[model samples]
Target: MELKSHSPFIKWTVRLLKKALYIITPILVVSILVTVSYLKQTSEVISKSQNEAIWFVLQLTKEYSEFIYQLQSYQLGTSDYNDMLIQYEILWSRFNTIVNNSLVEHLHQFEGSITEIDHHFTYIKAMEEQLLQLPRTKNESSLLLLFKNDYDDLQIYLNHKFRLSSDDLGNKINAVSTLEIIFRYLLISTILTGMIIAYLLLRESRYHHRLAMFDSLTGIRNRLWLNKKLDKLAKNNQAFNFYLIDLDGFKKINDTQGHHTGDIFLRHVASRLRQLEQPHCFSARMGGDEFAVIELIQLNTSGATPSLLPGKLVSLLNSSTMISGKSLTISASIGISQFPTFAKSIPEVLKQADFAMYEVKQQGKNGAAYFKPYSVSTMKNNPLSSVS
Candidate 1:
């Protein structure tokens, strides 16, 4: 059977899959970087944690060699064995604690040797308890008493225990080497992943540079982006106005119909605005429910300040009904200012337009207000208040 025809849906699916792969590749790289870092960190933690145990082992063996002479002296000359016994008990307790903590803290694949060390510590502890109790049976008068035999047996038993522990650790050295190897491989994998992601992100950024203004969410050019585009026809110092479009009662849509529906509504609103304006009319999302537009063709006249263009906005965004199965209508209060007319500077012009916008909000919800000079009160009466 020959499958000769190509399916459009299949081709589309393949394209989407490739796009997804491009996106996921960067994430994988980043994840590998983090993983490798954690592996290195874990290895360092294990290495540092073993130090206390190793040092204890060294001290314990040295004391064992000196222990017989100290015990014999204490028994013969009325010297107390209490200090020597106390030191030994404390060292043994500390050794057990360190081994137990390592077993619990390092449970990953790298901690197998640490776990085995804890297993041997059980015998070490039993040997320790037997040694501490030996002090009670000491006698000064008998040089060849029953206590001497017991003491010799105790010392021999302890030395043998220490030697056995040392051999067990010799076997675990191979384990440490193995863990170190694994960590190195993990670290290398992470670096490769990071490089691949960095490359993909660069490609994505290159594609985005063509867009004059980007949506805060989807990263697409907006009306404001269109207006502020440096490539406009302003070759001879032509002036242009900045017009900001806003959706009135956008909060109502978000509040009544829920945010997911509101997001879809906003995207639709943006798409519609994109379609109405020409390529010369660059636009962008100014903020939530707010948009901007700039002219493609340059002119000598100033196009600054509230570019509401009279009732031009009212005609543009006045139609809407039923978003997300709910009846709805959208409107906006426009504010406009003239270039080099309402205010001398861009900052002043924007300030005047913003002041006019507040006036529209105060007057009513749906109307345009142009920049007009008005006095703002710097001082209000101090009403009688007991709290102050």
Candidate 2:
């Protein structure tokens, strides 16, 4: 009964947790998916940026190499001043194109790679007048050598910058990958936690269900369970014997020896009643000092009469018990009712059994009686019989 009283709170708590899980689980999943997608996009963008940086630097190096080749051809008399000047102009144009491009602005973040390129371009531009006079000036070979040295230095610096950019991009990719892994783990953990909570809730729900169906103190089926079973049997038109047993002298036990002793005595009585259980035989505690039993008539193929079972019940319950180191004795007044015989419905059968039990109590208790329809009206007029 204590557990039964707390059932409302337990049910409310379980419902609340279920609703929270239902709402939170989807939000967490969507959040994890969004985060992973953003990280993937970020990785792809960094990779593309690194590739563009590398390609840009390589293109500058190739243009400078072509310009050198043209200068060498002019010095060897294979190309004229016009050809060399055109190649030089093409190289300058290429440099200006890269400098004005948006990609170069993004490359500026790569440890000053663009700044280095700008410095090299400024130096070459300052020497432009002398270079255009190549194959005509007497200092052509010296100028060519100086230009080659500057180009070589710029190539080396750009190569180093590319390496730094590659390393930085790789670290960024790895960091993003690590973040994706972490979020995946968090998602898995959240799902597992939710599953565990759901399992525990199901288990707790079943536990409370058992608490509702059974007597808490005596560890037997309770009145609610008996009513359900009886209803099921009656609906199917299954014939069964119903026994309602009331413990005599129970209130005296509680008054003189305390409820603790009364409770102990009830437990012993329930244990004895449980011994009567068999195939198609059910026993339960209906409440304080009250118990019920059901036995299907069809299962009794041996043709055992209903009278024999009540006699056995009276004998078992009349036995003495040892509680708190003292010998205690108690008896029961049992009422017998049969389905489709004394009553056809659960309420009618129970009412008839209760009437018979009251008659037993009026006759001095410690006995059993079958329900008589005519006796019910007379018993109802009298005040309820008290526990001995």
Candidate 3:
């Protein structure tokens, strides 16, 4: 029987690992989704900030141009100089906000931009003070007329500056959008890749677990599985018959015909044993030329013969097999031991059956025996009469 390879610590460690994978898979997916949502929100905030900066600078330039128009009209006696000074003061405040505000400083930080804006504000302040002190005269009108051409040229330059600022805003927004798309794609791909890897690992673990429970050569329950079955039955207080079988003269055939023929013979024997399939009947290949069968029976029967099943199995093994265009014949010596009758437990039952099979092999090579507390009658001798 195969003992469990994992210690208690190892088993718990493996179980914890499986549970951690289950827990982390969902967390990983949720984290990716949250990251995508966060990035999207960040991109929108950045775009909003850029739009605000562009709108502030353009609106400030437009108001400053209007103030220049008011100043020029005051020289023609069509506008009050006080009104022109108010507009100039408002433009100065707006320009100060755009240039000094931290939020849009990056957009306005051109070479000598602060010095140039300060020069404009200072010239406007000096003109406002001088106009307040002068009498209304034609000499003053000529002085203002000379500055009209400079105001027109400045208007043209501000319009071009607003257009360039708008274009830069668009490019920044586009770059932000592209980065968001790439980040979202990368997060989704990482989630998908993790899911695939976890699924494959789970499938491989299940496959190996299944392989460990069955015989690789004969495609039947192995000794470990049979032992586990008997243990379960014993736990349930169920009574069953344990048949231990050893193939007779199988070694002679294997020695002369090679292991290929030996494998064929073992498969044929396993197939024949499986033919005894019925409710509560199971067969197993217990390594090499040894095999076993388990059959559930009544707890306490009157005058029941334990050797009846072994006799049937012996007859089954005596049948002829054809492999590789050559006929082969083999016989088996089977021993019967009843659970809770000859032995009280699973391991004891198997040991008793093993002893009985050895007794049969001792008496003759092709017969069956029942393990008993006292000696019993000898089974009829049916040796391997032919092996062709």
For model 3, the stretches where C-alpha displacement exceeds 4 angstroms are 1-87, 96-192, 275-279, 297-312, 375-388
Which candidate number has the best TM-score? 2
The residue-by-residue lDDT of candidate 2 on 188-280, one tens digit each, is 878886886878678787877889898988878999999999999999988888989999988999999998888888889889998999988
Better of 1 and 2 by lDDT: 2
**Number of clashes in model 1?**
22
State the lDDT of candidate 1 residue by residue for 70-118, as single tens digits.
5566656645668656655655565465465545343222334444445
lDDT of 2 at 172: 73
In terms of lDDT, the poorest run of 10 residues in model 3 is: 379-388
Model 3, 318-342: lDDT tens digits are: 8889988988888888777888876
- Residue 82 lDDT, candidate 2, scale 0-100: 86
TM-score of 3: 0.60
Native-to-model Cα distance after best TM-score fit, residue 238 in candidate 1, in Å? 3.2
